[model samples]
Target chain A: MTNRRKFLRNLLSVTVALGLSKKLFPNLIAFDDYFDDDEFIIRNGWVLLKSDLDSTNDY
Target chain B: MIIDLDTATKNVKTADYDVCICGAGAAGITLAVYLARAGKKVALLEAGGFEYSDQSYDCYKGKNTGMEYWGLDTCRLRYLGGTTNHWSGRCKPLDEVDFMERDFFELPGWPIQKSDLANYEAEAKSVVDISGDFTAADISNWTSGKFIPDRYAISAPTRFGDKYRAEIEVSGNISLFINANLIDVRLNKELSSVTELVVMDYGKKRFTFTGKNIVIALGAIENARMLLNCDTQLKGGIGNQSDFVGRCFMEHYNINYGFFSGNPKYWKNMKKGLSLYTDSQFSLEHKIGNGNVSMSISPDPPTGGGRSKELRKYIRNNVCKWDEITELSRKFVDFQCPGDGILGTLMEQSPNKNSRVSLDKETDSFGLRRVNLSWQMNELDKRTIRTIGIELAKEFARQDYGRVQLASYILDENAKIPVGYHCHSIGTTRMSKSPEYGVVDKDCKVFGIDNLYIGGSSVFSTGGGTNPTFTIVELALRLAKHLS
Candidate 1:
């Protein structure tokens, strides 16, 4: 299968599997990918649209 | 002369309304237009004042740009039109994969379809002035299109402050309240139905806005923070029984470091594209993923005279036409941001429970507790990046665009990723059909909080590879129909 087809197949299996289990998708858990590498740069660097609450006053 | 939540709720005029909207943004405005035109009594509450200030865009310049954000410590603002006043205006709809329930990652799709949103597409189109039905634009001369064999699309970057500001204020049925911030939700013990919403203005910080039904159109971060902060009523927080109130946060992961060969007509058009900065779109099909990878092009280093000159050594020698020569550089230019170009790139990040907002006892200047975000994305997020980067690079060579200089995923271990808002932060107070996984139901109502509804990008389940404003408007209209 093309990688695209494989991905589609994977998506279908998830639906079928989840449907078979019929259990709810697991809810969100806290996330923190503080890796020091750049491979996952996009993942770790997403700032909220207006993320100022976390800023400090010391500056 | 001071009115608190208790005093106002008790003594204020209790009026009935068909629908009450919140957040005055793309979603809120669409809901107001739909409901009020239908003769429904609708009140839209926004925290920021209207867009008539001299300092409106003065905040986006430099260090001050950080202050214009939403949080007290951040630079975004709180206002009638929400953060969109400063939004770069890139707009795209979530793709079908964004609606799929993918198992490869923690993200899940909504129990909805792209077709379900078909009715509102026209409305979204007319609002943004998108002329045609086809979202993708044609791009054939570019080398990237040679192998990828796909076209680019003309995306609409709707400036809400300019576009819908007057329409919302002038609408007879839509009562838009400026300087109104939703602080809390009052409800009975059953926790399913909410009674009254607690609000605050700038001075007193305690203003009461009562409604038969309430919609929280506050942006994503604030949406979760508002619900989580309303801890007085619910034990785990309103509609937060699963403790998912502030979890599953997602944003488009965007980074584009590539070179361009400067073609003047193409260069001029590319320069024009860059000047708008926040309003272009691209697609990257990830062979390994359920959702195809798409990119919103943002303003990168302009691909004019010198920048392309520096890249001539890397440029491919085969020249077809002089026009294609200048234009193809911006095409190969790695403006590979993951969102519409108005604000910046936003790539869909699969949800990770670790990426979340946790409340601290420390309050904002408004007495709201600070919500700390511990955002994270995993290797799956990189799977498409490497594939797309190589594929796009190959396209550059195939079309003889250049030896395209796209960035390598590998870099210094200590390198910090370039980050910016796509004007699309979603998934904090996610939408689910059931309470087990989300804060809001399919109709965008808080699962257990009866009178409370959420209308914003925050209700998105899986952050798709598109600009979110168009989808935000579509989803808000869908939620409104669920009520009337």
Candidate 2:
């Protein structure tokens, strides 16, 4: 029971650390909301997922 | 001195010279300058005086039975500068492969190799006022590794009359005759050497000009016409013993087909590399089709808010609202509007014997028989163009540079290809090693004749995919050197 509690505490600590980093370096996760915009994905030099080109999420 | 035979005395005395060049075009004028500099007494004769006139241009009128062409009289100007007065000044050397025979192209290859003209290219450049080197490496090094190293440059389009007239007027050994038309090329009793040239002035006065050597430096059509009409002595033609004088007509074919869209990131670099009139070449390997293709990229103009019919049609078809598409166009970089952007093409026509010029019953003002030009193309031309288009599209997709949308005509083999010409008529008096294949020999001398020679693109064995003026000047310089 103590080991389980320690693992949960460690996982929560990493999550909080990442959350704090989001405020300091926003560019890393800034595009998490635009997975639907093909132009935005292409503009950022990322390949378009097949699902992005299709409307029904075929891929 | 530049003298007009039209103003000469009624009984003009016959003049004798070392070298008499008939037709003062690019080739004749260039040869005149070279020979005169070597201290040879040169006589340069031009059909027209200083500028164009309707009477001089009337001799160019003829029939075009096969392809749609610009009016015969409208295509080549017959003034003192010849057709260079209207030249666009695009100059590129013939590629090495163009001088060799390829099985894919019909009757391909030149009797004289590119190395034969190599020594004279620099002088040809100076003559044409091409100030820059045509090495592709000298251009932008930023192309996406797809362009072949076959670059071209422009010229100031040095009109020989405007540029060399002052020197020709002052040169003591050179004489320039204006409004002197070559009426006949009379040969000796043995029919081996040219005896004299019968020249007619504008006022109907005829005079003889005898020389040690004579050169027919007229343009392609006129060269064939002059030879074919000289049947008074030779039954067929002067060099028509083998009947190859007016065979194998060729020209550079250009068509506006296809669109290419590029990424906005490399838009600036791409524009710099593929600017207007910049020669960027690409060739296909054996696996695909061994043909060369060149392209010129241009920007699309803005079309929005009822400004374009295409946008209106798209709106009606629900492709997109005009405002939405316009906004999208503004958002994307280097987005090519339909019918805009890069034009990829193959300009070299396959040499065809059936595409020829023959004498018609019609006669010009000079009493010479008119030319019946049959400008024809074949299935190979269509197949080559389609293959080039497919290869270009594949390359663009493979390199991730852009997307190519080919025009419907390029995709459909049965599509009626337009017969419009690029105004580069070539290969009427093609050069060959044997008289069986061509009219002129490797040295551009008529096969059977001893003293007569031909100049201009008429002697081109195969018209490579570039302007012929630069090659014409190079060959003229080489011929002058040989004669000297």
TM-score leader: 2
Which portion of correct inter-chain contacts appears in model 1?
A: 0.00
lDDT, residue B414, model 1: 32
Predicted model with the maximum lDDT: 2
- In candidate 2, how many Å is residue B279 off? 13
Model 1, runs deviating above 4 Å: A1-59, B1-14, B51-75, B135-137, B141-157, B205-207, B260-345, B411-423
lDDT of every predicted structure (CA atoms): 0.56, 0.73
Docking class of 1: incorrect
Error of 1 at B297 (Å): 13
Question: lDDT by residue for model 1 over B115-228, one digit each (tens)?
Answer: 888788777777666766543323346434313222223444566656766766677676766656666778876767766766665555455556678887777877787888
Report the C-alpha lDDT of model 2 over B1-484, residue by residue, as the tens digit: 8778989875544567889999888999999999999999988989998998888888888998877777888888887879898888878878676677766666646887889999999999999998768845333434444345456778887888899999999998788999999999999999999999999887778878989889998899889989999999999889999887788887777764556555444444554444222122333343121333444445333345554656545533442335334323322322344323465443667777888888989897778899888888866767656666655555544454455555545555666765446678789999987888889898889988898999999999877667889999999999999889
